[model samples]
Target: MDEQTGSPDMATGSDRIAGDNIAAYASSAHSPTSESMMSGGSRNRKRSEVFATHESPYFFPAHQLYNVVSMDRSTSYTLKLAAKIDRGFFLASNDWTCYRRNYFQISACFFIPGLDTTQQPEVPCLLDYNGELLQVNRFLICIGAQIQNGDKAIELVQHTPKRDKGPQITPKRMPVRAGGDLSPGPTGLQPYVVTYERVQFKTATANNGKRRAAQQYYQVHVDLFAETDTGAQILVANLLSAPLVVRGRSPGHYADNEDDDAVAAAAAAAAGAGAPSGPGTSSSTPYPADERYPPASSSYRNDSISSSNGGDYSYYPNYGYNSSSYPYQSLGSASHMATQDYREDYHYNNNSGRHDSESYPASPLSPSGPHPHAYMTPQVQHGFSPAASGAASPDMYSPSGFPENGGGHYQYGSPTYPQYPQQHPQDQHHHYHQEGQQQLNGQYDSYNGGQQYDQETQDHATQLAGLRIHSPVSPSSPLIGSPTGVTPRRQSFSSALSSKKAGVGIAGDRSSIGSTRKTRSISMSGITKRAPSKTRTSRTVPATPTKEHHSNGGALGSIGGVLGGIGGLGGIGHGVKGLGISSDRIPENPMEDQQS
Candidate 1:
């Protein structure tokens, strides 16, 4: 309703739209995935080639319990909660956002207590991620983490230092305790997160002449976390004892608790009036719940300004989605009674949360049972029960579960958590090359000492020898590439030999070398061979006696022919004088006589 623009204030409507746009634009800016720290924005960290784009959970988990100095009452206290979630790790509108757990990747991290010298405190030194001052190997959960988890459950696993195709480590389910504030309030939720900021008055001062200097201060953005699983919630409870809450500080200055703590408080007051507290245990109450998973309504029941009992809380009951601690005060309501009744349930782990391997004991038989005051009444929930939670069993004590920090607090990659078995930084280093098409180091790739594609070639035809590829070839082979990143064409090499009998080959007979042609050469073995010539031809003229070389000393000659010798032997021939024939009967050929 603008007074000047009589047409019903379009400017005012536009203002509303602009405000919505701004809110939408910045809604997820603070999430751990998108946080500047994980985006290679930290001054202490250099760009990592191993991890080009930042992973979803880029920071490590740091529990305050492990940090002895952080627990001191003199400095500010922080409750860091980490949970495992899916890969994307997007913040959830419900279920207090948590990261998916990967036991293999879970490790403990720690930082120096609050800043003692300044108004604010940071872990004394810079921690890249995980518990490491260096970021390269932070995301990897060492072999020790698996071994530790194995000791707690009935699962066998082994870890190797090199890149070998070995069996993977399969661990048992995480041990989750059964007893806790199943009320869905501060203690029951899986892990609650509320983002808020505070301006430090100690750091503020004004110095511009007496003209009423505007207040100067630094606004501290606080990403608060609280445990949900009884396994981890117990750890949180041991740290926060009693602190009276201040009712009026900076009111909901940031985003209000998405759970609507105020509306829930009014509902609690109504429920309290309707159902008066009795001496009955939580089992008799209508809201029997499992500590791990609680009903939606029961979650914020204790969210009222201040409960009668000062059980652990996420923020100041009265202050703006206030800080974890509050101004001291006394309680006088059923809330106070409730806190007193359930105090004994908080102690799940010791100062270090390590279980004695030699004498691990179930929660029921733990010689070191928590203080008698630290107990919770039995509560029920759908699909779960006290016995079903087997988390209290000694075998389930040490699980490889990651604590989550809601709103991308970087639980897995983000904080200081439990001390995992120490891993040699050297073991985790890996060479990262450009991820496109990689070249084969050797065509004869070997596995377990056996050859791959490259092997010896069989012999070829009789005329042509075969190629026998031995293990080592000359480096000058055409296939070998230098720094040019190029490969030459593959040449076919084989031994070719001349025929053994001129017309023969290993496969079959070959065409005869023409009478004019002959082949001879050396092969891969360096042996030389020559081909035979064409077949012999028949003689045309008769040889003379004088030209003949006699083997028996006499030369066989040809004489003139006589036809009547048989008749002369009968004594009727004219050529024989003793018989009846004369010399005229046997005569030489006239041609022969003429020649004589």
Candidate 2:
């Protein structure tokens, strides 16, 4: 110490040691401490000595440590992810079995252990391997195929970027009591759960070129990922469901590569053999187990095969049997023969009960043959059979048989049957003419017989004529007989005469007499008479003049008076003059002439 201040150096060294120990203690105190360690340390010390003594017990453990415990860096909590299907039990063995084109349900849940599940503890924030905060709250499910006893896996369906997005759970801040005040506690996020209620697979399990024993098995894979700044994904949590069996359209039947090969072979063979191939034929590609019998076509007549007689044999190739193998005769031999053969075959098949009743008629050769009621028409079903309808030949069966003028005419209306007699056209025409002439002669005789007058009718006619002559408007000629050549049963002539006599002295007498006289006149010179006045007027006539007698111009006055009388008589004279001249004539005013 005297050599290099030894005492002072020793003191400095001790103080440095103490200082390092104190620094170590302070550093250790400031370092992060676990809840359990902190609790143990607190038990060793007094409760009053703790920094947050007035804080609630709930705040002491979780709330007080909230700021100290970084959720992004904490390793105490771990996410336990799991995936399960609702209908995982198979009907046969309680194992999972999925059928193609069917729906199923899948559910996934991720939670932390050692937490009250009922409390719905939040899914704590996570950090990836790089220590970067993970910001993913959703997960996706993928359907993959795994071959039995195989090492490799095949993905059938994968999640898309945006369209196949998953569901997310939002974080919520829970309230808690700290000391004497209410404050926001740790964020609360319910368990991360998502459900795919109607998950369906359109494709069946594929063998992926593996052995038949190594059939396909399906699995549902759930993945959680966080997006990076470059839009890349970082895997966080992943889970896989149990293996399941996916079946094909036929239950319990698994299709493999061998079946596909067999189908391809059949299709190639059909194409080489010139068999019809289309949607219609492809639908029936599933052949039956029995190889001896071919699959039936949708119809008996396909569009490919045809006969020389405009018939259909298209179904022959469609029967899946070789057409050349059948024992059929040449179709060009005869149309009737070919039809008969077809009918026989149809009947044979029907008799064997191999075909349904609706396939064809009961019998094509029925006694009534194929009438309008059945499917086949009469023209196609049967030829002319004389025994059926008692006809001589095909010509005799003709609906219009033969013309009337022809020699061998078959008349339906003829009383005789089978044997129709021939008749001459000239004779028939003559017969019709005779009937018409007889009718005309009868009509003429009726007309002449009706015109003849009987004696009694003639006597009535004379009386009617005499009465007509006395009538003011006498008829031009004597009465003729009635059209029916009948005499009046009630003597209507007498009644007519009495009616004329009663009308003789009426005011219409002069016009009636003039009209009657004019009807017999040959000349048109007839005077029109004026009607008499209501008050009758009298007129005086002078004496006639003599040739030797003369008295103070009395003869001239008599001549003038005679002329005036003649002028006054013009109305009556003119009416008389309208008639033809007669040998005997009546004088006008006969009573006055006799007096003179």
Candidate 3:
């Protein structure tokens, strides 16, 4: 019940009587704020922490001293004993008291953090109860009872706690622990054994005007067993008195430990032996081991002791002793767990995709390479002019030490790896003659790998070859093709032959060429390959006729005219050969093409 409600009875029935015991409030004066309770934190500390640091506002520690509520000086209660251990033997007592001045009532019941009700680790108290017999019952439990010399006698009760407000004032009829069952009462007024002790909860000054001693009420603790010289003994010791009851217990094992079984077995064996016993104990003993369990009380045998330890392995914020006495909680919903796992997988898949460098953009710091460090390394053995070569500067080439594609930039099948040269427009026909000759002679394979050259690759190679043609026989020689418009030579034939011999690589007189027109055709059709240059030029300069020839070569002067007045190199070549002038060179017998 909520303490704020202040109902007439907060909790009714046995729940109230067994609600919070005196052990829950022994340190009520120093009770922690409601926030400090073990909702869930480092709550499963050692048991010593409970007694020292914990407190409840309305409970007293159990197994401690308790004071009687009221006592009457006018009445003197008498003590008595039971006749013998016999069933259906109706016996009454004048020993027990339920009268007003002798009986007590509870004023409050609230819990303090002390120990659990299960008594798992060890037995704790049942506090805030009245040991008073407010009503009479046939099965009276004589508290502080003893057995000696085959007779039962009542022992004196001891303890002194103040009479304070508690929860249950009447007799409590409930199990010792929350989940256990209560044994049935014997007769109409069957009572079970119980006792009480006292505990000091709080004591301080109270003042209406000036300071004064507080009119304080101490806590009372209830106990289930009493202590004796023989050993610790329960008040309601044995209740299985019937014969049929004995037969029922004969089959089942109640105790987990073999020790209890041995004790019971030993007692049974001792009784059955009956080796001529004494007169008073002469009657045959029945199932003497049939001892009744404490009614409405928890078992303190503690079968699972390992759970109570607060060691490093056992204690955690979520488990240990706290879990044993309280309800546990689940972590989260199923969907939430699935969502978290999916998020992790999503990130992993994306990362795995990027494991290939081709998936991402290139780095800005360094570029990929022909050589390992192509972008920045110097070229020490550059064999040709940059313009002629159609190559990037030496600084653009990579060093041998680095990867060909140093920056991981290029995708598969990049155009950068092949160094295809650019074509020079002026040299196309020149290279074409040489290329056709090679094709006829089966000299070199086509640069295009037997396939036709793509426009780009053809352009590059043509430009490179055109720049290299600085031949000894300069096409710019005046007599070869003059600006005076393809006129006959002014000098003698010997001078021309000597000049030709000195300027070109042929050995015999020019007359030997007359024997084979096919050989002449071969020479006219192709330019012989030149030897390699000793020192490469850096600048690329185009060779051949000047711009004037290119501009006027397209126009023909007449049918027999050789030099075209206008147009490109092709037009000029065709025009020169059409006339019987022998535009390239005259045969040794210059009269031959003239005679045709």
The candidate that achieves the highest TM-score relative to the unseen native structure: 2
Q: How displaced is residue 509 in candidate 1, in Å?
A: 51
- Please rank every candidate by lDDT, starting with the best: 2, 1, 3
User: Model 1 compared with the native: what TM-score?
Assistant: 0.18
Candidate 3's residue-wise lDDT over 1-596, tens digit each? 01101111221211121112211111111111111121111432221122111101111011111111112323221111110110001000100001111121111111112222122211122211134322111111211111110011112221122223221111111111111101111110001111121211121101101111111111112222221112212222111000000001111111121222222223322332112111011112110111110011111111111111111110011011111110010001000000011111111111122211111000000011111111110101111111212221111111111121122221111123122111111111111121222221111111123223223333433222211111111111211211111110011123223334422423323445564311211111000111011101010000111122223332111101111110001121232233111122112222332332
Cα shift from native, residue 343, model 3 (Å): 73
For all candidates in order, the CA lDDT equals: 0.16, 0.21, 0.15
Q: Against the true structure, what is each candidate's TM-score?
A: 0.18, 0.23, 0.13
Candidate 1 or 3, higher lDDT? Answer: 1
* Candidate 2 lowest-lDDT run of ten: 56-65
lDDT of 1 at 320: 9
After superposing candidate 1 on the true structure, give the runs of residues whose Cα lies further than 4 Å from its correct spot.
1-67, 70-596
Model 2 lDDT, residue 163, Cα: 15
> What C-alpha lDDT, on a 0 to 100 scale, does residue 198 get in candidate 2?
29
